[model samples]
Target: MTFPAPIDPPARLLMGPGPISAYPSVLRAMSAPLVGQYDPFMTATMNETQSLYRDVFATANDATVLIDGTSRAGIEAAITSLVRPGEKVLVPVFGRFGHLLAEIAERALADVHTIEVEWGQVFTPSAIEEAITRVKPTLLALVQGDTSTTMCQPLEEIGEICRRHGVLFYTDATASLGGNDFEADAWGLDAATAGLQKCLGGPSGSAPLTLSDRAVEVVRSRSRIEAGIREEGDASADDFVRSNYFDLGMVLDYWGPRRLNHHTEATSMLYGARECARVLLLEGRNAVIERHRRIGDAMLAGVRGLGLDVFGDVAHKMTNVVAVEIPDGVAGDAARQAMLTDFGIEIGTSFGPLHGRVWRIGTMGYNARPDAVFSTLAALEHVLRRFGARVPVGGGVDAAAEALT
Candidate 1:
């Protein structure tokens, strides 16, 4: 049963939660020839990648580095290494990814305490502070933006609250990093993790992470050195990190001047991640963030022009994504499928309780362009019309174009 190796060039609109339109420069960087892991050039490339990510993460920590694998890998590395079993951790669940943080902590055998809000709303800093006061959690785990409901949880106040409570604050910024503002040091974020796939305009294989000195101390105390790498009578030989692969302790050593080997580094993905951060830095993080804001505004106005109601409190919507309420009697999945199959556009749907009830449209990464904003709007309007939903022809695109202009 031989299958035809047909041309796999799929039509290219990416208005989704993640993997949103990789930058052409990033793709080119990935295609560059790979070098040996210990090659001088490769070592330099690793250093440069870490430096670039430091700027993107807005952190001065020397430990800022990339974790190979997806965003969840970064989450696992940050949590498993920093949180010892029985350490109390507070997690506030605003959406799906908050649940993910709780799950990771539980797997690490952390004493986890969680406070959940309704899907679309965010927990106030005071609410989280109260929880922290009650639980006396040593680590506070949360997601900056949960793409499931297109909500950007307020972080600034929460970070300060955690500081007062003596809680090390950690965040998963996978869906929000490049498109939104984050200050690792200024916000008192002890540790933070993000994936390159979302707003970073790169592939999903690398997760960028930055840890404050306090967070680093936690990792250092729990660290265990593997036997093979240890020297006889070495003072640090006994500190074997709990999870060998996801150990930030070893990862930092590998990324540091020691340049030790943990695994075969994902060279191509590192190149891609480096280039992604380079592009973001060149554009200026604040400008890139503003671009996402403008595109999201255009997309939101376009969705409204199509006679659809947007979900969530508009005041708190994430800068890179929007959640639109699927109108009554309109088949959300069918319209999404039609838009994908017929028009070659990909918009995302919601998750958890809002699944099938809302459409999560992304204006992020390379797809935050004006063309993508209008094309997605126009395609969505056409698909909704086919489903007998009364969307005004040309109105959506016109509105988007107006905003984009």
Candidate 2:
């Protein structure tokens, strides 16, 4: 049987919601030679990655480590390890990803309760607090940024409220971590998870996770040694984490001083994750977030200049992505495909309520730049005009340029 030639894909400027182009440094790092899982160099590299992610997550938690999977893996690890079956968990839903958290909690056999606002809006602190007070849940699970609606839920106040109520707080920061303002320790977050694919400027294979001391305690309480590493006195919890592969207790031990074997670490992905954090910290966290804000602002203004209506409550939107309403006559999917086929660019489509109504454009990771933003705006204008929508030829690029200035 004949097989295909060596894999090659087209070059594209990814101006979509996520999986944006990775930083060159991160790509280079992934090509480094593989090392043994317990080699001195490998363990040291793991330790260094942990320290770097702590800085990136804005936390001092000693249990900070990378999960050897995508961002959703981090979320499931945090949820499955922290909440035993039938434990009450509260999820505040504002978008598709918020509903995702609730769904994951339910699959963990959690007694999940959810309070929701409209798709394009975020829940206020008071609303979340009211639900928390009524439910008296053991954990508050939420999403920091839900790209489906291009909304960022303000977490500082909600974190405070969760702390006062003695609830363990966890958030999925996959789409917003490096590009937005997030304070795991200061915001009273007990557990937080993020992916390298979005704002971290790397591929989607690694997930950086951090756990506060309180969250660590919760996971440790459910600790159970794997059969391969069992000792004479080892004891398992009455309700061990359902998924062995995602058990934070075992993962923590492997990442911790014990170095107990869990799984052979994905060495290349770990290198990429390390470089992603290094690039962010070297540039300074605040400066990277500021870059996202500036570019995101330009993207937003550019879309508006094309006579497009922006979706959601603009005041609480995320810094990395924006949702623009689809024009009356333009076919949403067809326009996006044209942008890809004709221009070698990619833009995002929405889900759930926003589907068929809005397009999600992103300026994030390595592509969060003046050139990328301007190029996307220019392409969008051409596509809109070709689709029979009225748009000024140079309006999008001109507005974006002005915003950058």
Candidate 3:
């Protein structure tokens, strides 16, 4: 039979929101030899990975582990496991991901409540507190970074609000964890989930999650109470989490000292995920955040130097992504395609309300460097000129260079 050629895709500088160019070391880790699920080496690697992520999340929680799917999988695992059917889950909507949280919770059969701030804006702690007081939800599901709007919601104060209201605080930190400041323990977070594709500098197959003692207690209570009911044919409890694969109780046990079996470990992805964390920690977590801040700032300055207006409130923008308004008469998708097909660059476009109106450019992960930022701006300047936008000769690149220095 005729065979397809070796899969070779074009080299792209993925300057979009995620799945950015992973670190060279992380790529190498994925190609390492595989091992048995129960191998001592594998278990030790798992323990080491958990330790690395504790440093990454800035928490000492013993329940840190990886969810074996995309960042969305991590989000689902957290929501489905924490919220029981018909229990209230409060979601404050500010962007596309917020709606996703509500949708996930609803599918889990939680009574989902959502209050909206306008797109491009974030909810204040007082706003969240008021809602928590009124709705009295069992859990507060929030997105720390919403790339669709390029907003990084301030989580430090919201954590306190959840604590005061006796609500479990959970955040989807997939896009913001390594790039911004996330103090899981200090922020009073009960649970949090992150993906390796963003600032962690890896592919999207693995998600790092951490659960505090308070969250772990809740998970254990449900699982322990319903442990033997299945065998006794007494389905009366109905409290076991709806999913075995996503059940944190089983997942924790698998990662814990018991070495119980759960999902067949995706060994290669784990390797990549571990390396991602390792590189971040080696460089120092705060240093990585500062790097992202510097690069993202340069990108922002570059766009404005090109005479582009930024989308949303600049004060609340993420440290890794900036949304710039598409110039009048410039076709958004055509410009994006030109950047891809003509320059092999991939800058993202907004979703929903902001779609076609703005371009979301990201400086994150391995691509968050001055050279990458400069190259992208130079190419973007050419693309803008092609679309008949009046772009200055070297305005973008010059501005970005100035910022970096």
lDDT of each: 0.87, 0.92, 0.93
Question: What clash count does candidate 2 reach?
Answer: 0
> Candidate 2: lDDT of 14?
93
TM-score of 2: 0.97
State each candidate's clash count.
6, 0, 0
Task: Supply the global lDDT for candidate 3.
Answer: 0.93
Which 10-residue window in model 1 sums to the lowest lDDT?
231-240
Candidate with maximal TM-score: 3
In what order do the candidates fall by TM-score, top score first?
Answer: 3, 2, 1
Residue-by-residue lDDT tens digits, candidate 2, 238-322: 3677787899999999999999888999999999999999999999999999999999999999999888999999999999999
Q: After superposition, how far is residue 104 of candidate 2 from its true place, in Å?
A: 1.0
Question: What does each candidate score in C-alpha RMSD?
Answer: 2.7, 2.0, 1.2
lDDT of 1 by residue, 1-405 (tens): 998898687866888888788999999999999999999999999999888888888889888898999999999999998887788999999898988999999998889999998888898888988899999998999999999989898888887888787889999999999998888878889999999888998888899999999988887776555334453344443244557799887888888898877788999998999999999999999999999999999999899888889888788889899999998898889988998999888888877799999988898898888888878887888888888888888989988888877
Error of 3 at 57 (Å): 0.5
Could you estimate the TM-score for every candidate? Answer: 0.95, 0.97, 0.98
Q: lDDT ranking from best to worst? A: 3, 2, 1
| Cα distance off (Å), candidate 1, residue 43 | 0.8
**What's the CA error at residue 201 for candidate 3, in Å?**
0.8
lDDT tens per residue, model 3, 283-326: 99999999999999999999999999998889999999999999
